[model samples]
Target: MRLQAEDGDEQAAIRAELEARAVAGTLQLDAILALSPAAPSSSEFDFLSALGPVQRQQALRRLLALLRNEEGLHVGDASRLADVSSPNFYRLRQLWRGRAKSGLGFLSGYAGRPTRQPRGVGALGTLGKLAAENSAFELADRSIRGLSKLIQEEQSARIPAYTLDAAARHLRQNARNMPDVLAARYGFRILIDYCAVSLVASGSDGSLKLVEIAWVIEETTQLILAARPVLDVGGCVGQQRATRAARWYIGRCGLDVPGPPAAWIKAVVPDPVSPLDRHHVDRMVSVAGEEHVATTGARRFGRLVTDVIGPILGRIKIIPRATLSENTSAANVRAFGRDILDHQSIRARVAQSVIAHNRPIIDMLRDSRLPLLDAGDRTGTMTSTLNDLLLRKG
Candidate 1:
């Protein structure tokens, strides 16, 4: 039967291409670049056509190169295949290394460095050589110095003056006062709003930005300040009492309190640029202190709880035997609850009394993930928007 142009035909074409490539021992990229006689029309599929034939071919070649070199290609081999010098190759390699370590393997493979491919004077080789010559750290330091000079010039300051030092001091002072000011200005409502915004922003941007985290931190710190009155009045005398009272009334009931610090999240949360895994969450929980994590779903809650108290158990380094489940420990659970509930702000947030906060403005940048995405997307997240400044082939 003749296939429908919209779905069936496209599926058939794709399948045929896959089968043919499988038979020909070509990569999927190679098969696609080969171009089918029954290729979809531009009107029917604008996205694929937008790539154009030349671009498709180039992309396909890069893909194949990555597949061949990813595993076997070392620093030297990549430069040779990219047709770049050793120095240039080093830079690309570092960029790739940074990407891979950050959980962005998809980007590394596509940009350069595929599995087991040997590098020896290819299209990307020459670029690699150039990159090795330019170091990212050196580039960042120079850029900072240049910015300092420019700011000084704009202010009509002395030639030898350093403005960065002053800026740093000012920022630090502001950060110190930020917690109290937040409580006075926004209150609990703004704190919740900020957390919601942070979640959305973090997902949209691929990774959380400094500003997003800062908002959360600021809101959270303020929330903590607001809760002081309740704590001061003997609302709960000791840590255990606070935990029990909070658990009885607030836990998961949506109480709203100040959330964990940005520093806590930054230290705990794994690199988002990389692929997600259960282990990453576990590691985060270990650092986060189980008391601080709020349980939502059942298994997810258990995991979060374990993550909170896991470190204190001293069993973090070792997996428990199946038999240990029978010898349950109530003390551990009580301790976890008490430890978390003791902190008024933390308890409020966990109990849903207040919104979980993000990083403060000053500490916002300590764990930003934009640079990884920029490097992956070919859009320069760090360095500069100076792609046009650099010499390149069309």
Candidate 2:
């Protein structure tokens, strides 16, 4: 074609027309919209701006093929051929497809799949509405039950290994002047103190494991409810203080309790004060150790809740087939109908829901307060054995 010049003429008009067509998504409208919004804009540019250079060129080539095809096509026909919607093709008209539109929604120079009627739903007819309703109910029931159990498990404690281990460590460290039985009692006492500190620390930092946070919130709420008649009592200073602090913490965070907001308890706890003396320090450590062991049992309880409720979850699986069969017998009807029910879309949605509901539980598993104990057990056992050997040699 002749080039356009500074002066307006036939060549300039043709150039202007071509530019408009290019902007309209002349041929590969479907392909253009499929591109990221950033794909290239000019036909002479040889690429979709949204696509990278290499893919842009490839897209250009595909558009060119669609443009050059001699068989005429309507917007609907073009969409069917390109596996895109007719509406998308229209939007792409000015943005660039492959070639300019020869007519409204019709590709002047293309021949592709001749339109035909949609396939029959005979297989689906066999299942009718009854089977779908039944399946829906079953899935709903399972999902609700599974979700309820999952929530309960995430907020409770069951195992006490950490609490116990903390106690043992404290006793070992400071039992020089005490009998073994007396040391054990001191160790247990230390565990309780440590547990209190840990709870306070976790509450302060909003870093308690999700289940632990939930438990704390629930227990604190219950305590507040139970103490309504005794909030004015002289002995309830610690209790009242803790309750007020917790409520203030939650309120300042602008979060409602019994939800993910409970996880913030760890962030609300104040930092530990330094031990006033060696004796006090030892007592604090011993108490904290015992508390850690007792809290470990919470994880076990969480797991049990998960086990009990997991079965109530909804499940859906999709299956694809090459083509519908000619046979319409009862057995064939049942089998084919079941196969069609396997839709990947439904499964994907379910996966999303599960992730959303179980987020807190997963977060709990990652808390630092709840490190796995296998490594600790191995180290402790090895240390004790080596110490025994050294003592014997001496």
Top-scoring candidate (lDDT): 1
Off by over 4 Å in 1: 1-67, 70-77, 80-85, 98-101, 105-394
For residues 41-148, could you state the per-residue lDDT of candidate 1 as single tens digits?
323211222232433343343333332245355656545444456786555455545542322122221121222211221222322332345443332223333433
Candidate lDDT values, in order: 0.28, 0.27
Residues 254-300, candidate 2: write the lDDT tens digits: 22212111121111111224333223323323422333322222122
**TM-score to native of every candidate shown:** 0.22, 0.18
- Worst lDDT 10-window in candidate 2: 190-199
What does candidate 2 score on TM?
A: 0.18
Q: State residue 121's C-alpha deviation in candidate 1, in Å.
A: 38
| Local lDDT at 90 for model 2 | 60
Kindly report which residue stretches of model 2 are placed more than 4 angstroms away from their true locations once superposed. 1-7, 10-54, 58-123, 126-132, 135-137, 140-394
